[model samples]
Target: MLKKITLVVATTLLVTACGSNSETAGSGSADSGQSDKVYKLKLAATWGPTLTPFIDASQNMAKMAEEMSNGRLKIQVDPSNKHKSPLGILDLVKSGQYDMGHTATYYYKGKDLATIPFTAMPFGMTSTEQQGWMYYGGGLELMQKVFKPHNIVAFPGGNTGMQMGGWFKKEINTVDDFKGLKMRIPGFAGEVIAETGAVPTTIPGGELYTALDRGTIDALEWVGPSMDIKMGFHKIAPYYYTGWHEPGAELHYLVNDKAYDKLPADLQQILKTAMRVSADDMSVRTQHMNAEFLAQMKTEAPNVQIKTMPPAVLNELKAINDRLVGDMVNESPMMKEIIESQQAYQTKARNWGKLADYQYIKDNQ
Candidate 1:
């Protein structure tokens, strides 16, 4: 009777142990399955790996996205060297070869004329004004409408507050100085410059220094001191003109709509948040760097003379710019809508800005 009782107890203990092990195994497998799924994305940047602030925006955005998503979202950034399509980033992402792209919207003016104003127009809003307009003044909606046809969702990537007009090999004193001159400028500004009898060409950023150095191009309008200092433009071009073309040049991040849609809702929010935060980061970073570098240029590069176009010359360019914009507005109702929206916002914002910022600066200085 004692032996039979012990056997029964042993059988019960084994069954309970087996059941516990099975449950543990099942739970572990379930948790592993949920955590193991990762979405990998590819981004093509118009900038090379070393381009500061510009490249920094995309890299910072990727880092933020991965951390916020807790490793579930991974973005691999490919610079112009790897992608070999500096100017073709919009097409690369739109066709799905790349999940996203980092570039300036104005670069694709030939593709769609309506895309120009999303970036800085000639004598357009300042950086703060543009940001306000984009986030609050319906500029973002217009941008989406322009990009929708290409299956792209665009976001502001970064902004260079006020770009310098350009670096010139010779001092431009009169309107005739631009005659027969070849310049590397882009967007509506390029068209405006063209009206002055100057030839305007858009060269890839990586090739700009070489183009200017080899005399392939006579002058080029890169961003201000922050980037130009690194490119060593001041070493070659003695004349650095003040900005009028791109008052607040903004770059854009272009995402493939399908790829963006595939993201889980939470991850979608994370992606956009990352882009916004990183873009704002770049703007501040650029301002800091520009201030530091501009001071350095003044002290170290004495030969690099800062210049502004004569009033007559500027008036001519302005007239030409206004006429070209009118022509484009007539060509596309969409263009008319965009210009009207921007102009409307600019008028309202500029009024406040003149008092809030412009007057403050005038009084302080």
Candidate 2:
């Protein structure tokens, strides 16, 4: 795992297992390049290099693809620092400017509202439930259905289990406290918060710390302690809130339709399998990092207060979230199918999980 996978623009391009006589897997190349052929891929990421769970997921995917394909597939990951367009990864990949991209479906809600649910929905499925819904419960089909028109095939790249609500400069006790509050939040969660009269600002990952430090933003939600620790938000914000908005925020691995079509059968499967492994690895890694970083926070940043939002405020947000989804569903036929599918799958999955994992955790806590 220590071996480097690949690099990008102003980044190193590593072909780890390339034979000395390897050929290019280019479309017009003579050698049909099966054995020693190297397919060079460029992947743009929405996360900055310092963002762990996201960056780690991208690297792991590249490594898996390289190792599995014996260097036939080499992906160079370019973070926002390199690309300077974290929020625009979807466009980068869709335009074929990049072969692939690591981003969340929710970021492009303005372009396509249907992209929202594939990432996370406020008060929707938990991580486990969402994973089940995605693979075994017809979730991937719906996701593909939404992305097909965009000319990019989206895959589940990574998952951050139950995300922390955010770091707040002040505790939110009542519903009125949300009004006019500026926060760095993304996805549909931003829209959900905006419903409470709060202004939701989508800041790039690298800019969040400066934004919070300079009082440019009142609060922000940047994953859990794992990723946020590097941002040092705890130094400025004392109140760390529990999650409600993003129960299971999922990252997306987007592949350009034309690019993916060029891959041979074996390499295509290898790429898909690599993505699957990366997705699962991120979930486990996130859980581990969250636990370790949280402990680190308690010891180093002792002043940070971990608090849950008051039920009154949570109820208001939940109400708004439900109304928003309900309205979206009624408005878009595709949204209705996707939501109905998710609900039907998640409800049953949650019930089954509740009796075992849920009860065990609940009783112990």
Candidate 3:
């Protein structure tokens, strides 16, 4: 009886050891999976909450990033004014102070003039054309070259399709009226405005409303009807103008090179995909909002006058813009490359525009 009892106890002990080993192996595999995972990122943007589409897109990007990573990667976005000036956002991202940022490429002209092609030039391609160039015409690769030295990876984020010409306290009936007008303009456009006998000032968006209200600025140009309506420009400045000069204005999302490189290959792809989605969503939202806002403005602000800039004014501005581009190309080889690429793409795209976009607008009008 004693021998049988001892044998049973030994068998039970052996089974327990084997079970323990199996559980250990399973735990090790689970740990290996956990070790491969990473966590959240931080993104920044210069625009405020009032820019609903941008804010919404950014939030969507964060959500998508988290989902794509299976909760391993997360992105936290903050307003630029909360941390740094809008113009300083790109630099902050490049330095790894922020994981990512959204801002205007033109705002960084002092860094590289090639950025102008990525944003807007006087008489540049419309929003759709610019997107085609960026996605297919090698514009994205060239932009990468420009930003590589700065240690940032840039992606097209949002666009304000054709902005207003500007708000004028008085009608700009002719080229002479453009002379001596103090307009709040930024980037290369400011230089072009200066050539037209206007003094261009760079002011933060938050402060622009007050400047215009107080007559500190004689004229001001912001994004489009949607943004203009949100800013309540019609209340202060009764004259609203069309965006002939800036046919399409593009915005960008810049990511820190090191931070981006650290991400897994799948995560990197996720970021790119998120940006493209955001870009398309933003464009659609802006178009719809502008149509609605324009209708609302017409009813709400009946006294607000909407007028187009004179053809003579546009012609002169175009000439000035050409000179500006030439001077910029002379300043840097990168600018030269960008200009060549842009012109090549423009030539190709303009043919389509002439036959389709331009003709449609002309016929419809």
Candidate 4:
């Protein structure tokens, strides 16, 4: 009987050990199946929350990144204070103070002239055409190469579409009106404006309203009708000008290269997809908002006059832009590569636009 008892006790112990091992294996598998990994990133923007279309578009990107990674990645976007200044945001992201930031490329011209290409040039491609160049015309690769040394990866986030010429205190009837005009313009445009004898100052977006209100600046150019209406510029500056010079002003999102590479492969893909969606959303929203705002302005601000740049002024500005671009290309090898590639793309794209867009607008108008 004792021997039988011993055998039964040994069998029970063996069964318990087997069960524990099985449980351990199951637990291990469960832990492994939880999810891939988690990466928390902070995205900053210089534009305020009131810029609904832009904010909404970026929020969509955050949502996409989360869903694409199955909740393994979370991008937390901070509210922008225009006080931080758009140009300052890029350096902050590059230094790892922020994981990402959104701002205009032209704002960073002091750092690298190549940044101008990333933004819009005078009489450059429209929103759709610019996107085509960036995505498929090797512009993306060139931009990546330029920003790599700065430890940042830049993506085209948004476009303001074709901006209004600007608000003026007085009518811009002749090229002489540009002389001594204190205007808030940045990047390459500022350079060209300087040639026309305008004092170009890089001012923060938020401060523009107050500046114009107090006559601190003679005139200013923000985005188009949607943004101008929001800022209530029509009250201060009565003359609203068309935005032929900017054409399509592009905005960029700068990501820390190290931080970006640390993300899982799936997460990287999610980010790329989100950025593309945000770019498209920004364009669509801007187009819709501007159209609505234009109608609203007509009814509400009858005193606000819409005018195009004088033919002589436009032609002179175009010539100055050409000189500025040529000078930049001569200064840097990278700039040369970018300008050449963009010019080639623009040449090809312009042909199509002339055939399609130009014909349509001409026929309809």
Candidate 5:
């Protein structure tokens, strides 16, 4: 009887162990279908890896997406070098060649004039105002409408608060100074400034410093101190004028509509939130970086005199900008709607800001 009991217990133990192994083997497919599966995406940026603020935005988004998704969703960011197509990001993303792209909306104005207002305008809203308008005052809606035709979804990636006007070899003391001046300024601002006889030319980023140094271009407007310091523009052009052209030059991320639509609901949320947070982060980081570098400029690059464009010069530019915008507004029904929407929002926001932010600064300064 004792031997019979021992044999029965051994048989039961073996049966239980085999059952557990079989269950574990069956669960592997489910694990592969769920938690063990990974999704990889590719992103392209208009900037190289080291370019601050712009490239920082792209890296920040990728890092956050991977962390938040527990490694399920991964994004590989490729800069201009890897792709060798900086100017074609919009078209690439539009055609679903890339999953997403980081670039400026204004870069594509030749294809669509309506893209100008999304980035900035001469004498337009500030970074604060533009951001507020985007989140609260239907600016995002208008941006989407403009980009929808191309099958691209646009989101603000970062902003360069208020860029310095440009670095010039000579001071722009009078409107007459623009006469016969050649500047490597592009976009709508290029058109506005052209009215003043400052012939506008478009040059690639790599060639800008050489162009300025060799007198190929009399002046060029890059970003503020953080970026400008690295370019050594201060050594070549002493006059650093404040901005009017791009009060808030906002950078954007372009996602292919189909690629975005295919993301799981959770991943879609992660991407959107990550982009929003990183964009805000980029704004604050850029401000800090610019401040740090601007201080360095004062001590190290003292010859880099920071000056504002005289009100007279600003007025002239403003007038030309208004006319150009007016012509754009009359072009299409959609242009009229987008421009009108921004102008409407600007009117309401500027008044409150005037008393709140503008007044405080004007009084304190």
Candidate 6:
């Protein structure tokens, strides 16, 4: 009887320990669901397959996310050519047809006036200052407010530093030169140009050269030297003017709200970090390419003449820009809020920039 009693006790202890071990294993499985589950996402971009820096931002972000997540997160990017919806990225992401999208915010101006300020403003902050406002000056929060209602989250994808005004077939010597001018411009800048008695139109990247070559547009403002060189605009329009409209043109990445919410906490953080790293890389890479290509312009396009718009013309354009923006602020409360925030931040940042960057450049030159 004693031996039988001891055997029963030992058997009970073994069963109890086995139960405890089973519970621990269940807890580990729960954690593994959050940490190790594989997520595959699709991204639709507004750019063509081979457009560098623009396409590079999306590609790099995908690559970084996969590596950072150790293959648990995979993003596949589809270019405009394959998707056949270059301008429909926002809609695609919003409907969850695409998990993400890469495009410019200004493209959605017709959808929401509040979206316009996020891209670039005429006579606005430089790229560096704009980025500072974005990361530090409550810009990101404001951006979320604008996007949340659409079931999308937006982040800065990349920036093309101060864009050139446009390539004009004829030189703009005075404000009168804008009269009846047909120019390819976009966003608020298009409105400002229209105020100058110019007909402003938005053309896709693929059709710009054909449109310009065939006299469909008298002038067109693409990007700076790096992008424009490949477009062969210099061969057609000899006059290359300086920038004003898009001082800091920033492209955006849009995330589907539902898709993002479904991600584990660690994956969410990883995705955000990847976006930031890739975006910064694109900004610096763009500057490097622009510098390198600008040097080659003299040899490639001998007829290309770099011209600055006249002071009188610039002053007139600025006045129009201010009036139009003021009108927008009055029209929409959201626009007013965003513009006020940006203006306040720009004022604080501009003062320091003048003392530091502007003065340094003036002194150096």
How does model 2 score by TM-score? 0.90
Better of 1 and 4 by TM-score: 1
How many backbone clashes can be found in candidate 5? 0
lDDT of 2 by residue, 1-365 (tens): 33233322101112222111122112322334567778889999998787787888888889878977878989999988999999998899989999999998899988999998888988888888888888767787788888889888888888899999999998899988989999999888898899888999998888888999998999999899888876889989999999998899889999988888778756766677677667877888899989999989888999999999998889989899889888988999999999999899888988898899979999999
The residue pairs that clash in candidate 3, if any, are: 163-243, 165-242
lDDT of 6 by residue, 1-365 (tens): 99557534543453343333221111121233566688899999999998887998999889878976889889999999988888888899999999999998898888887888889999998898899888777778789889988988888888999899989999998888989988989889999989778998887787899999999999999889879998899879999999999999989999988788777755666677677667877888889989989999988788999999999999999999999999989998999999999899889989999999999999999
Backbone clash pairs for candidate 2 read 7-12
Off by over 4 Å in 3: 1-36
Give the C-alpha lDDT of model 1: 0.86
- Using all chains and alpha carbons, the TM-scores for the candidates as numbered come to 0.90, 0.90, 0.87, 0.88, 0.88, 0.90
1-365: candidate 3 lDDT, tens digit per residue = 99457534543453343243221111121222353587567888877756677667787777766765678778998875677566788778988888898888888777767777788877788888888888778877888888888888888888889888888888887778878888987778888888878888877677789999898898899887777888877887778888766778888888887777666545665566666666666888899988999898888889899998778888888888899888878988988888888888888899998999789999999
The lDDT ranking, best first, is: 1, 6, 2, 5, 4, 3
Comparison by lDDT, 2 against 4, better one? 2
Which lDDT tens digits does candidate 4 get at residues 259-287? 88776544565576666666667787889
Worst 10 residues of 1 by lDDT: 21-30
- For model 2, the stretches where C-alpha displacement exceeds 4 angstroms are 1-33
Clashing pairs in 1: none
Candidate 6 stretches with Cα past 4 Å from truth are: 1-32
Taking all chains together, the TM-score of candidate 3 against the true structure is 0.87
* Local error of candidate 4 at residue 270 (angstroms): 0.8
Please write out the lDDT profile of model 5 over residues 188-305, one tens digit for every residue.
8989988998899877566789999999999999888978988888889999998888878888988887777666655666676677767877888888989999998999998888
Better of 3 and 5 by TM-score: 5
Clashing pairs in 5: none
Quality of model 3 by C-alpha lDDT: 0.77
- RMSD of candidate 6 to true structure, Å: 13.3
